[model samples]
Target: MSDAEVWTFNVDDYAAKLQCPTLIIHGERSDGFEAAAQHVFRKVPAQNKKLIIVDGVFHTRFYDDPLVIEPTATEVAKWFKDNVK
Candidate 1:
């Protein structure tokens, strides 16, 4: 099998074994990754899990766009405060 296929093999099993809190950040415009994120979210065993999809931008925009980054950072900070503390 290809490396990508090999890398994803048994991914659900790994996700199921996760015990810590997880925050999944996705861009609403990143349609390609949205389903994959949802799949992993469903598979993860952690009760303290969150999925935040920032609106109006694609994947890479999360790195530079203020509109996306601001909300994403807010969510991340909230997650950290709620879970890490």
Candidate 2:
């Protein structure tokens, strides 16, 4: 098995053990790691689950694009407010 395959397996297993509320934000242009994000998001059993797909955003755009970052932060804040105590 390759290193990437091993990493994927470990990440999926880790995600399956998460029980807290989860907010998954994915860059639509990031084809590389989107499947991993989706696997993690689906594993989380949150009453309030959020998956925000920022269009036209690349993998690293979250650090550079205000347009994507702002909305992601807003949604995450809302998810926390709605779920967390």
Candidate 3:
């Protein structure tokens, strides 16, 4: 089995079982999470689903964005405040 296979199994069994609204945020410059996040979003069935791809950001931008980390932080905060129960 390869990394892809292992991740596929986990996503299929566990990630797919989430039963609530979901918000997926990714960076345009990210490589690691770009595909995984999309795959999870496609597999998981949610009432309200949102996929936010921040332009000009890398994989680590979530932690330390260049232009403005505060904007990303604010977006996530707002999303959770509005969506999560």
Candidate 4:
């Protein structure tokens, strides 16, 4: 968890190195999250990568809210179906 802190380290290098089918899902209302998510989405090298913006939700809430999580789960499942063998 300590290694994941943005203040301590950066992932842009790793983001640029991604070679797998990537799925980027984030909520619509986060203050600075959308831009960061888009930045990572742009860096992914995978041809089959996707960026999904979930509606009526915000960053942390997307993880816990049933209303938001269910639909987001559907999108995740679809991404796996289309990208995974």
Measured against the true structure, the TM-scores of the candidates, in listed sequence, are 0.78, 0.73, 0.72, 0.87
Model 1, total clashes: 0
Residue ranges of candidate 2 with Cα displaced over 4 Å: 1-9, 45-48
Name the 10 consecutive residues with the lowest summed lDDT in model 4.
1-10
Q: Rate the local accuracy (lDDT) of all candidates.
A: 0.84, 0.77, 0.77, 0.84
What ranking of all candidate models by lDDT puts the best one first? 4, 1, 3, 2
The residue-by-residue lDDT of candidate 2 on 1-85, one tens digit each, is 8988876766666667667767778887897777767777887765557777777788888898788778878888887888889
- Please give, for residues 6-70, the per-residue lDDT of candidate 1 as tens digits: 97798678899988988888887886888887898899988889887766679998888888788
- TM-score for candidate 2: 0.73
Ranking of models by TM-score: 4, 1, 2, 3
Clashing pairs in 3: none
| Residue-level lDDT tens digits of model 4 in 1-85 | 5655767666788889999898888887887688899998999988888999877578887778898888888888987988899
Q: Is candidate 2 or candidate 4 better by lDDT?
A: 4
| Shift of residue 62 alpha carbon in model 4, Å | 1.9
Higher-TM-score candidate of 1 and 4: 4
Off by over 4 Å in 3: 1-9, 66-68
